[model samples]
Target chain A: MVNILANPARFLRLAGAVLPWCWAAAAVTGGVGLWLAVFVSPADYQQGDSVRIMYIHVPAAWMALAAYTLVAVFSAVALVWKHPLAHIVAGAAVPLGAGFTAICLVTGMLWGKTSWGTWWVWDARLTSVLVLFFLYLGLIALRGAFDDAERGNRAAALLALVGFVNIPIIKFSVDWWATLHQPASVLRIGGPAIHPSMLWPLLTMAVAFMAYFAALLILSVRAEIAGRKLQALLVAAGRNEPAADGLQGEAR
Target chain B: MTAAVTEFFRMGGYGAYVWPAFAFAALVLGGMAWRVLARLRASEGALDRMRDRAEGGRP
Candidate 1:
């Protein structure tokens, strides 16, 4: 099992096979989730329609942290076990993670302003999340800085591991410190405090976001694998020999 | 039908914020998808051309 997963070609083939189902899952869940959040669910008695933002905000917030954890785990694999696909997975996921964090912050700002009358705050939860976004940006920049691919991958993976301390900070921020942000409504020691009417849509959107991430990750990883193959071909061509073997079926 | 449509569009007077929130989500996800597909296609094109050239540029 370990060897099977450690091989890049097998992983790439697996990603291709799983890609279509992931897209289908994302579309179905996203469509249904949006419908439930917008039309089927009742409005909050107090916050009113502004609560609609939760559908987008909550899922994005979930993904923001989740993606970083993924990066951290993959980075660990690359650094410790030298898994071939680990660094590629970590590097390719940065932009998507950054995007999710951006959505979370922006939607949070919108919700905050509508509810708390403030667009910006120095609260621990918000600040830590902002730091997470910047951490992703830094890894991306660090990866592109090195001319040698191995050195670049090593540096980025190391940074990913070092920066993983922020994930716990972001998750527990609302609890560890007093903040304007709400705390532990769904994923808590006890079951969800939210009503079923609201919880169902939120869960649906969460599934949609996870599906979206899976689909995007596979596509991005496939691109990364193809990119490395292209690079290998280029290097081989420098030796005045054919490099067509690596190019076969890679276009698909 | 008209009233229901209007109400839905209104989003209970939070239309400005609500609409933009969803729009941003769409933009982020959609933009990422577009970028990834472009990368895949570009790699595919380069690989195909290189392989063809290596095969004596045969059709």
Candidate 2:
């Protein structure tokens, strides 16, 4: 399947077919998840309604990490195997991952304000996630830093692989240090410590977030592919049109 | 019914933080979705126009 999808045309065709379903899944699941999170689930006995933030915060955080991991894995593939789609995918995923990280951080701060009685803390988990956010920004900046697009992609890919060291740090930070941020409840060794009342909605929101990310990733990848084709066409046109228009030729 | 709705929005006095948390999530995700879709539309439009120009100029 990976070998077959290495062909851009085949990949585009598969993406086109899968895109509609991803959008549908995102819409339906997102709506249902929101409903469950707001109305169906019971409030935390201690945290009260503030706990509702977890529905969005935790899921966005998960997607933020998941998306970065995606970029890193594909960057490695692009670097090692020299797959064409891999670089485009890694590049396309950066903005979405960054957006997710922003959502996570902001919502986390909001939750923190209500729970921890402060807006900011330099705890292990929080600091590491902040670093992850910066890594996302660095990848975006690195990708556009070069005149040659391929060179930029390679530079960004290398940075992505290097930045992946932060992922595990973010994951283990809560455990390894004394922090205001709580350790893993849902994704833990024994099992989820969260009650079924809360767990179901959390899981539902996770699905919604994943479906949303998948839909957006596919859309972004399509845009990147189209942009590349447009660039190629423009280059070809530039080569052809020089004798006809000297003014434009000078600009080129 | 109105009171109940108000209470739901109020969110047991944590409304300020909770509502904004959800709202920002919606804003960020929705805003990104719009941008991505617009980009796809713009690129596809450009590709079509270029293809048309190529055909017209060549033929």
Candidate 3:
């Protein structure tokens, strides 16, 4: 599958084929998740209604980490095998990852204010996630600074790989150090700490967020390809225009 | 029915915090989707114009 999608045409065809289903899944799962989260799920014994924020906050955080993994994996593939589609995907995923990180931070702050009685804290998990957001921004800026697309892609991809060191830090921060953030609940060794009532909604929201990412990522990649085509066309037009404007003879 | 619904929307007095979280997610995701599609449309239009100009100017 990855080998075949190394070809941009094949990738585009697959993306187009899958995009509608992606949208449908995002909508259906998102709807069900929201209903369960807001209406059906019980309020936390301690946090009360504020626990509803967990449905959104946890999924965004998960996606933030997942998106960076997507970037690093795609970047590694791009760097090793010279896959153009992989580069485009990693580049397009940067902004989405950053957006998810932003959601994670904002919702966390809101929840923190109510739960922890502070708006922001330099806890290990929060700080590392902040760094992850910055890495995404750095990749975006580094790519834009280059004049050539290929150079930009490779430079950004390499930076993404280097920035992946932050991922493990973010994942383990709540564990390796004492932090305001709670330890892993759902994916821990002894099984989920959360009750099934909260757990089901959280899992549904996770599925919704993943589907959302798929739909958005495919759309963004399509747009990025179109933007590249436009740039190539404009460059070709500029090169051909002078020759046809009767300046061809003077050059010769 | 209406009172119960309104109470639910109140989010047990945490509406201020709860509503905004979902709102931010919608705003960011919706805004990005809008921008992506708009740019794609504009680029396709520009490419078409360039192609048309090239063909017409050939004669």
Candidate 4:
């Protein structure tokens, strides 16, 4: 199934058909999620209205990890199977992942300030997430560092695969070390510990964020493919020559 | 609605932190979407320019 969907043209057609639905779903889910999170969900007994941030923070954090996993998986497929579309999909995911990671960091800090009386802490979970953010930056930077597009893709793919080691570290940081960050509530061996009222909106927002990521990622990949086509057109027109055959050319 | 709005903005006395967090998230998301659309438009413009050039050269 993955191999069959590797064709760029086929993927593009499928994405076009699905993109509208993804966007609509994201919008609908986000609207409902926000409503439920803000109005319907009961305030935390301890945190009060500030608990609302969880509606955004938790989903962003989830997507941060999810997006990185996607990048690593796509990278692996692109390398092992030599799927061209995989590279584009992985490359398109970097900015979105970085954005999600940033959201997690910023929101975590904000929540921390209220809960822990500090805006920042070097706790195990926080530190590992910070490392994950840097790994994303490194991948983004390495993608453009080579002179050959293929070389850049390969190098970025390798970095993504290597950097995946941090994902597990981020996931288990709270368990591995006593930290201010809470242990898993929604995902656990015994099942979610969160109350149903909070759990529903959280899950809804998570779905909304995932759909939003899908929509944005498809748009980014389409833009990238279009940009590449434009470059080819320019080359054919003799209006411009291909840039230096380095990794940097492929980075964008 | 007014009471809810007031309460939300109050953020139970943590308004400073809460509102800014929400605003920042919105800004980042909005900025990303805008940037992507802008790049798409720029690429489309370049394609148009190339097509125009090709047509003029042909005539």
RMSD of 2: 4.3
State the C-alpha RMSD over the true interface residues for candidate 1, after superposing those residues. Answer: 2.9
lDDT of 1 by residue, A82-119 (tens): 88788888888889999999999999999898889999
DockQ of 3: 0.53
- Assess each model's interface with DockQ, reporting 2 decimals per model: 0.60, 0.62, 0.53, 0.48
lDDT of each: 0.89, 0.90, 0.88, 0.85
Q: How close is candidate 1 to the true structure, as a TM-score?
A: 0.94
Ranking by lDDT: 2, 1, 3, 4
Model 4 alpha-carbon drift over 4 Å, by segment = A239-252, B1-4, B52-59
- B1-59: candidate 3 lDDT, tens digit per residue: 99999998898899999999989988987887887778778877776776666556664
Q: What is the interface RMSD of candidate 2, in Å?
A: 4.3
Candidate 4's residue-wise lDDT over A93-161, tens digit each?
A: 998899989998998899899988898889899999999899889888988898888899999999999
True contacts kept of 1: 0.69
Ranked by TM-score from best down, the candidates are: 1, 2, 3, 4
Chain B TM-score of every predicted model? 0.84, 0.81, 0.77, 0.72
Error of model 3, residue B15, in angstroms = 1.3
Clashes in model 3: which pairs?
A: none
Itemize residue pairs with steric clashes in candidate 2. Answer: none
For model 2, fnat equals 0.87
lDDT agreement of model 2 with the native = 0.90
Residues A3-116, candidate 3: write the lDDT tens digits.
Answer: 964777788898899999999999999999999998899999999999999999999999999999999999999998887889989998999899999999999999999889
Q: Which stretches of candidate 1 lie over 4 Å from their true place?
A: A244-252, B56-59
**Measured by C-alpha RMSD in angstroms, how accurate is candidate 3?**
4.3
